[model samples]
Target: MFSRAVRPAVRAGSLAVSRTAPSNAANFATLREIEGRLKSIKNIEKITNTMKVIASTRLTRAQKAMEDSRSYGQTSNTVFENAETKAPEDKKTLLVVASSDKGLCGGIHSGLSKATRRILQEHPEADIVVLGEKAKAQLSRTHPNAIVLSFANVCKDIPNFNDAQAIADQIALLPNEYGSIKIIYNKFLNAQSYEAGTVEAYSEEAITQSPNLSAFETDEETLANLREYALANNLYWALAEGHACEISARRNAMEASITWGFGPEPD
Candidate 1:
């Protein structure tokens, strides 16, 4: 009878051990999960921090270039501004959206698309020429037929005058004559804000139709050349400023991501 009682006690001990074993295993599994999640969050944080640094570096150069281009572009368009030039109401409109190939810069491209759509609503017959893949992709979905031209990698780096000239050359080759060409781009307002705006390039006809055109004496050939030059200048300016806006927006976005817990929260 003592041997039988000792056997029952051993069985009860084994049952108690079995019950505690699962609790220990569960705790270990939870710890492992938390460790993995924390590791992932840390990696994301490092990546975002690196990207923010890069954007900050580029933003400085881009803003400087934007300022320089602003002066150049303003000088080129001075004549038009002085003459109070306007586009003919009866002619077709062409919108050249200034955007970049790369994304991840907040709503930079989307803002352009929205602005384009707004303009399209007012003028359904307007044609579109997209400067970057991002805006092209968005516009293709909504206004495929209206897209007359598209360029990729146009603003991959800091834009130069040559890049703008090449684009203007292509635009000139298009058979359909546009009465007005508007370059739509994100105008940088501040470090954290941007908005879509337009730089207008009037056609030869529109230029001639200006009320003050009679005051400025110019030959037809020279006028044509001036128009081409002005177009390229405006394009370069738009590209530069848009690029700056993108960089600033990207930096802000990365910072916000880390601060606002874009990734999984760490324990």
Candidate 2:
């Protein structure tokens, strides 16, 4: 009787141990999965923080450049503004889209795209010259055939006169004799704001036909050089301001990310 009773107790204990073993193993596996998720979150936080720092570092330089370029661009447009040059509605138009290849900058590119679409609604015959892949992709969705030229690998850094000159040279080479050239870009309003803006480059005929052209004494050759120079200058200004806007937008996005706990808690 004692042996039988002892054998039953042993079996019961063995069964309990087997059941508890699985429970322990399951708990360990759950803990491992939790640890892995925490690790991934930490890694994401690190990357976000790094990008935030970089954006902050770039913001100052970009703003300063934006200001200087604004002055330069305004001065370049003085002649046209003074002359009251108007684009001829009868001729075809060219739109130069100033956007970049990189994306984490919120709606900077999309805003420009929307503005372009709105302008196209007004001038459906306008041909597109996209400066960045981001804008190209966005415009291609609705206006694929309108894209006359799409450039890549631009505005990755602060824009310079040389970049603008190269782009203007390419535009000048296009087969169409565009009546007007308009550059669409993001205008930086403040640290947390930006909007779509346009900078116009008048054609030689438009400049010559301006109602007030008689106020400035110049020849055809000089007018041609001025047109090229002004186009490049305006392009440089637009690109610089757009770059600043993008940096600011990126910084704001990072700030929002951190606020939403995508990064480490603020100190």
Candidate 3:
């Protein structure tokens, strides 16, 4: 009689557990999902933080380079500025788009493409020479025939004097002649802003015909050399400034991406 009583109690306990089993399972599943999401958030934040630091380091170096390069370039062009030399009044010109090979920054390279298109509309006969791959890709789609020369890896790292010199030498070697060369680049104003600007590189004829050329002690040969050197210096300044702008833009972009990632996911 005692054994029969014990059996009824055991049956009641089994029934209670069976009723609550599904409820326990549901709670465990919810907890696991939350844990997975937290792990993902941590990983994503780590990646963004790491990239931001790298870009910040590069930005500092680039800014220093930009300052020094600007000084050197302006010194070289002191002759043109002082002589009041002007570009020829012809529409035919060489447009040297100073962009970079790498990307992932905001609107910098694409902005160059838009500026180039605007210039092309105004000067349809102008020839295009791209100093970096990013602008080349964007321009090729719209103005393939206009591009004569395209360079890659020119802005892979901080630009140097030699890099600019090499590019200037190649431009000099082109068979087609241009009255002037316009170097288009992003002028970094502040961390949050940059504007597209053009720095004119005068041709040999323009340099020689300057109203005040006779004031300088240099001979014709030296003047020719100076023009070439000036082109290289101006290009270096543009490349360095553009690189700095790109790094700053990249840091901002990464931070924004990380913030968006951590936001609540859609159901």
Better model by lDDT, 1 or 3? Answer: 1
Arrange candidates by lDDT, descending.
Answer: 1, 2, 3
The ten-residue window of minimal lDDT in model 2 covers 258-267
**Which digits, one per residue and each the tens of the lDDT, describe model 3 over residues 41-68?**
8997898788888998889899999998
Candidate 2 TM-score to native: 0.87
Model 1 segments beyond 4 Å from truth? 1-29, 263-267
lDDT of 2 by residue, 1-267 (tens): 459769989989989987775544543458889999999888887788788899999999999988988888899799899999999888899999999898887888989999999999999999999999999998999999999998899988999889999999999999999889999999888988989999999888888899998899989998999899999999999999999998888887877887797532221
Weakest lDDT window of 10 consecutive positions for candidate 3: 258-267
Report the C-alpha lDDT of model 1 over 1-267, residue by residue, as the tens digit.
Answer: 459769989989989987776544543458889999999999999999999999999999999989988998899788998888999998899999999888777788889999999999998999999999889999999999999999987888898889999999999998898899999998989888999999999898888878887789888997898889989999999999999999898888888888997832111
Q: For each candidate, what TM-score against the reference?
A: 0.87, 0.87, 0.83
TM-score of 1: 0.87
- Provide the lDDT at 171 for model 3: 94
Instruction: List where candidate 3 sits over 4 angstroms from the true fold.
Output: 1-38, 262-267
